[model samples]
Target: MARGHWLDPLARKVLQAMGELPPEPSARPTPAAPPEPPSWVVDVNRASASQWRQLPGCSEAMVDLLLRLQRGGVQFSQAEDLIQLLDLPPELAERWRPHLVIHWYGDAPPQPPAPPLDLNAAAPERLTAALLWPADRLQRLIQERRRRPFDNLADLQERLCLPPEVVEQLIGRVRFGERRPGPSLPPGC
Candidate 1:
């Protein structure tokens, strides 16, 4: 069978001698596979705007629409509530259903209140931050307040040189003497 007749046996002997023969069984038992991880769920009601946009098939525009609904005093009780409130497309709703979840906290994120700032008690910084008034106008208001607290809306308008429209806007948050300032503007105001 020519010179190659002994080569196969020689090779097998070499492998056997070198302890490289066949696939050797392990000395120790194999470890069991690690347990599978728990699946993730996104709570629609509690998630922030950015988090909402991170869901499967979510879009920024859709998130903006949801935010608008939220700001407009809409409360979503569940994924269905969000779908209905947003008037989501049927196909889109189906796509989102797999990932959407709702863990209802005690309540939904509160809508900002009308008259969210108190003219009489709010600091210059609050007026600047909340009212978004220019510093000069805020300074004028501060100057006027130094003399006495605002007696009423008209007094504020007169002293602060506020326009009628601006006064209308401020009417919600402004308060006179004993009344407590509310946290938000009135709905539909």
Candidate 2:
């Protein structure tokens, strides 16, 4: 027998003695599997921020804003209402609105007849009320405003801790307010 072949048996014995060998029993118990994801019924008008994030194409930021708006008692008579609050593209809003399901807390209240918001002059409360932002979020936004004036609806959203989707949803609804005309003709002769 070759010297190298003779050493193989000794190596095997050494490995076995050291408890470095394979398992004695081939069968081993497997770990339990994880549970499946919950099937959530989305109520666009009432779903929490976290829940909104679950929707297809909805981002975490969007969900946050949506929840903030819902908590603030903002009404969604039509899904398009969200477009103004978030500053999203009209095409995008139309594309995503169908996936959203709006729910009324009770008998759907009669749509209030009100004029459009004046973004330049509206207070945070008015803005929040219009956008459906929760009280706490609205409060936070107001506090943030002391440091800097809001440049646009997006600026309000950034200060309000809103989700991107909610911001996107409101884009269409926001009215920047009509701009003042430039200096009149110096001399109308």
Candidate 3:
């Protein structure tokens, strides 16, 4: 057959299979790669929950806390404040760092920190008001406290399987008193 003949394709395959010719490029075309998403940046002090949610790894609880603080007139002056306030993991904070910006409206005097609520001694009503926990979760907390006071945040988290954001919100707002022993049994049955 001539070089440009119809049998050339078959001959090329045969030669390639026998190692007499180099393999031909695939007849199928490679698909084009998908385009990357557009990058976004948000001002930490001014961003709404929806705006903040666009960033990777931001949870609904975190956004809720952020908006709550924002509504209370809290403003972030630096990246560290957002990371520290939200108790973000180092890796996650790093991932979000690039997308966060700070724009201070004006300097304000720092307010005195609120006294931490005692988890062991506080009444259920007070805890509910302070923690804003769901009714069932608050009930679990009260019940757990009645059984034995929590030693610390870690203990509470492990006992309740609390989400990291909840534990983080409790950091300076709640304190666990020293555990008290249970009542002694009667002298005799």
Candidate 4:
């Protein structure tokens, strides 16, 4: 009987000359890494505001924006599409893209052509059409907008003298981007 070499391949070969197990299968091919799951897949049309909030790196404000877009018949076909349409910050968008997916719905009804209204820019008619505000209030808003553009959601509220509760109610119902008569301008512009 003979002891076997555990370390040296040559020694193992020598042992094999006498009779021993074949040299360990040449370094096992490195096992391929497992495929990653599509963890970021989000059903844009179906996800609730809360669900949207659950996406990695998403804030409450981001969720609101997403829901508003969804309500406006803006269907997200891909992460890139959502990133471009939302005009998300490049770094933030890139960081979150891996976890996002625009889930498909089979035989879903066609989306409305109209997109959600931009709080900073929507026409009085579009505002009326999209929101349930009274004509008089909408008129005041349009007039106020002309005097000085809304600074942000807060500015819109302040300009309109809306209570905090009212603003809260309007959260997912409106967006604050692209001023009317100024497609390139948002709150600051």
TM-score: which candidate is best?
A: 4
lDDT of 1 at 65: 57
Model 4 weakest lDDT span, ten residues long: 180-189
Error of 2 at 143 (Å): 12
Give the lDDT of residue 162 in candidate 4: 64
State the TM-score for model 1.
0.33
Worst 10 residues of 1 by lDDT: 180-189
In model 1, state the lDDT of residue 180: 41
- Name the better of 1 and 2 by lDDT: 1
- Which candidate should be chosen as best, given lDDT against the real structure? 3
The list of candidate 2 runs beyond 4 A from truth reads 1-41, 110-115, 121-147, 150-189
- Best-to-worst ranking by lDDT: 3, 4, 1, 2
Report the C-alpha lDDT of model 1 over 1-189, residue by residue, as the tens digit. Answer: 563324477686677567676422443358999865436555664567877876666778767655544443334444654664345789988867776775644534323345445567787777788877887888878876665666555456656656544653443344554444434322221
Q: Give lDDT for model 2.
A: 0.57
Candidate 3, 1-189: lDDT as tens digits: 554435467897897788777665564357988865448889887897889999888899788767755654556656865776566899999888878887866654233236778899999889888888899889888877777777656557656667655664565566666667675322110
Across 1-189, the per-residue lDDT of candidate 4 in tens digits comes to 546445576776776566565544563367989978765565766778777776666778767766654544345444654554455788888766666656655444233233446766877777887777877778868887777666445556655666444554454455667554533333322
| TM-score of candidate 3 on Cα atoms, chains taken together | 0.40
Clashing pairs for predicted structure model 4, backbone only: 40-99, 121-179, 121-180
Q: TM-score per candidate, in order?
A: 0.33, 0.40, 0.40, 0.44
